[model samples]
Target: MESVVIFDSPGKGRGLKAAKEFWAGDVIFSEASIAAVVFDSLAERICHSCFRRQEKLQRCAQCKFAHYCDRTCQRAAWPEHKVECGAIKAYGKVPNENIRLVARVLWRLDKEGSMVSDMQLTTLDELEDHINDMQEHDLKELKVDVHNFLDYWPRTSKQHLIDDISHIFGVINCNGFSVSDQKGLQAVGVGLFPNLCLVNHDCWPNCTVILNHGNQSAVSTVFHSQQRIELRSLGKIAEGEELTVSYVDYLNLSEERRRLLKTQYYFDCTCEHCKNKTHDDVKMGGKEVDGVKPSDEQVKEATDYCFQMMDKMDKARLNGDYHEVSKICRDCIEKTEPILADTHIYLLRMWSTMSEVKAYLQNFEEAAEYARKMVDGYMKLYHPNNPALGMAAMRAGVTHWQAGLIEIGHGMICKAYAILMVTHGPTHPITKDLEAMRVQTEMELRMFKENEYVYYSMREAALKNKPMTMLHEPRSVEEGIKNLFHRK
Candidate 1:
């Protein structure tokens, strides 16, 4: 609580304010969900109680609604599940995640309990709810669902149903965060973290959220037999500055990011990153707009071209036509690169796809180049230590090694491993996989280094009488060896 405060952010409405300056990687705070519901589609793989990926799970004998890792988790989750179980059973089918989430929210406001103060139901009352903005059919569906959830058939009061239900659903819509694992690769569930929700949206956020769903405990804390969502500073934050996180993924052009924010959160973003025209630069698009900014015409042209290329890439990928995808991706890159800069969100995906395609095709040198670009793009767009950037770094390292740049590849792997270690911890699958890569890279680096000295010495001996070579003119064997050493 001392780390942050809540106040009017003017154009942004209520926003969380930093109480003091904080550095990158600093933990602002951590809290578990107040009322989280694992989406039905993912429930089979993700635990209902702790949200961990479970292999050996047992169903609640009575309700058969949730699968838990063991008796302990089942018992721990019983209190919350008891009423929800009955509600779903009464519904005669599995309630969709939205309905279940709203039900849980209503229950918490009415009866559900939590172990943490920040997660208390009272903190949620002041949250924003866009009842007046909702569509007619959506409002009607929510009303019916709320009525069913609250068992309104037996109630005498009917006047407040529409208003109350709409308000609650609105709150959830505005504040709920789609939960993902530490790496943000899998959709696990959704939750209303009242305090985290208080942090306003910014296209270029100064903070990041990571959900830790592990059996291991933090150094100063016990692994609460539940999932934990931790918010950390992405970079240094000054006192009184508003703390913000991106509501939508930042790997999109300005227009797409705005579209997503408007559609999902129902708000217009005017953050500095959004206000800036050139977030990423254009190479040949009308008068270098500096960074990623393009003129209106350039924006439209790049947007249209990107969409067209994306459609082709998607269709080719779905059809398992890797060669077509690779070809189209290269065309997209070449076509867009001169007009669109590396910072363009479209290029990010293009570079990522190219890296994967080349890697699959065993064109290691080309794959390494694309992977490096992917890492560079992510580093520019994402917060420090983002899992995506870390993964990209690992990808670059592996491909660079495959391309015979062992020492450079090892260095990249080490960098990626360090970032992953801090963000994802030692036990996460991605972290462990990166750890394995780091070890292999180190082994290769050692072997390569060991041979390099002797090989270079022999080459030097043989080339002592030979002339040095220019970039284009290899005068002797020494020139070729030098070129190889420099990766020319």
Candidate 2:
């Protein structure tokens, strides 16, 4: 009973629509990737057999390219690994990610017509490759990649010529989804979810994909094991509402978003977000913004400074230097406080990063405070049900949980889960992890309070009935809170 209703649109070609009303925190559907390849950069870091991010990894004895946690993982991966191993041994290096994915697609098609569903919920033939729409340089680069991938085919599988390989390339260009970790931090792999690929892009999308549990072992995994593309309702969806997912980060400026959509997806987004200019852009038109705010030029200068500071903080954070990152972020905050909006992307990001740094260093009280600030910022910046909003709450919940404020952590996590279900789906790994923590925290609280369930039950009812809406018009904090309390 997965969500899979197709409808035609005047401009969007075949599009997915909700078959029934979906509550804000509901899962629309979940499916494993048909073709998946762990990126080379993530190979050593993540278990090749199970995709787990772990340090104690065992390399495949023969190929040396595959790393598993144990013999069990190595054995479970052997079936697929045998072929990939042979290909790598023949080539003397692991193939590029796109090449590997194409190989997986072709191999799966030859062995099993479709990877996820044999009934053909969707088809490669129906996918719009946008090959002609791609830039000339990209096309040429793809052609070379096709040739390289074609060499991996077994003698029997090579029956299809270069043209066939090109079609696979086109399909990938049209529908590939980067498989990121549970946190949506980094894309460690690429996967093709045939049924999920039916989703069309909306600049302000109603749904988002969350990766649920992926394989954790190299030795054994479930039959449909690579990765699951769990589609979650990002907001309350009425029956017949178009089910869409953003192909790019929602924070990208309007112009940048449209450009990426056009170049990559072969369509210009005309969604509401793209249709109306942003506050910054609108200010240029001489309209009065709703709140007391710094002049546009002043805001821009502060934002620019924050961006540069963020870049430095990011590099330091990546290299595991938390001390430097924390200082940079604090300076970033001090400078931005005067001119930038409270919900400025840079400001929110700075707070979120500092919270993470504190959490990493086990400064639970400080982490909780910073994370709570992030939650408020997210509430102002993103949609009511945005995954980022949920993630912010979850971060705060974890810090509270670590600080032994089980009651606070339990409530925050429960709230976070409700929002995450809308954004990451109920089954997403992130959602599941948070939910697990909530349960554990609740159990601990029960040992002390004994009547905690009553409170959460009432809170749950409130969250379920909260109306979904687009954010912002009140550029000031007062109106924002006034609007929130007034929401149905």
Candidate 3:
């Protein structure tokens, strides 16, 4: 019996419904991408075949563009790359990920004739493109892509009509999934997963998608280097419950989420969260200080300023101007702290950016503070077991650990591991890394508690031998660890 069945969802075109009861952490379905491509920016740094990130990669001698880890990966990718390589050489340059992806899809379809799997209820042709619903700007961009695609398309490959190419681009814009690397830390590419696309969207989804890149042990037998995705149940789902996943980050304001859905997916969300403006007040709420609360007008003004600053900060970050980004975040945070509540999304954004930039600048102590605040805000905004919250906690734990706050760092790592166990499961690379961190932290904490003098002595001796400069000096060690040896 199948684990999931397809049915026409009300309002939604088609939806996947669970055929049997599934508890949290259960794998509902696993699928491989029918077509995929590495991002153009990472084309050289990441393995074109295995999608691994490395400082140095071996470039394909033929195309002089496609890269690989070694001969094994090059051979594995040859079936697809054989055609792509010829096109890149013929065209004289590589196209964007979207165009390249469309080309790969066309090549695959021409070869296999788009056969449906036993469990697949929909085909690539049937997927909605919403071409008519697209805005003029979006359509214009699509037109540009279609033109470029035609130029880059090989004359020898199977020819596709202009309408077919346009429709394929439309489908991808709405349905394509971000393919993460093996550790699931960052998206290295984009892929088309047919059945996974059938899962509808929800503000608070009961299922989360995991892009399984396959590990060394599994790669040899069950899983391959191909891009595969898994749908995991986030909580106990009934047999007949319709499986859903969030199309956008659920942390956004209701209005923002609705705008994104309408613009990108061509659908106006009427999800309960959107309809009821759930958590909107808290996410944008203003706080009172000294018995004086901020007025609605003041709150709006402050939020507007924060939004403008965040826009600039994002651009600065993209430009690699960390100092400018840090300054903008600091200014926005200071200006809005009094008016906005601690959990306000705007403040959280600043904290998140500040944490990242500070960490990059090696201000570990300050970065850890901002990361802790970010995690605290996330804890309130996200579901108790949300994977995002777990990732944030994991990052905060690492920051704290880097700053030598072992007690708190150990606790945060344990918290992340517990949440990831449910969201990502134990076998995921990220979860495995967190588990190792948890163990190592626990051991260090035990050692420090056993004898802080000896622990500090060993650390000092190691540091003295290396003679490194400290970028961040902790203001004070936590009371728990500080008092262990001082109390006499």
Which candidate achieves the best lDDT against the true structure? 3
Model 2 stretches astray by more than 4 angstroms: 1-3, 114-116, 181-186, 214-227, 278-292, 318-320, 403-408, 423-429, 439-488
List the RMSD of every prediction in angstroms.
11.2, 9.2, 7.8
Q: Please give, for residues 207-259, the per-residue lDDT of candidate 2 as tens digits.
A: 77776655453333454354566777866789988988777655556787788
Query: How does residue 436 of candidate 3 score in lDDT?
Result: 88
Greater TM-score among 2 and 3 belongs to 3
Instruction: State the lDDT of candidate 1 residue by residue for 196-239, as single tens digits.
Output: 77778787777776676655333322444456677777678899
TM-score of 1: 0.76
Q: With candidate 1 superimposed using the best TM-score fit, by how many Å does residue 195's alpha carbon deviate from the native?
A: 0.7
* Winning candidate number (TM-score): 3
Considering only N, C-alpha and C atoms within 3 Å, which residue pairs clash in candidate 3? none
Better of 1 and 3 by TM-score: 3
Q: CA lDDT, every prediction?
A: 0.67, 0.69, 0.81
- Deviation of model 1 at 236, angstroms: 1.6
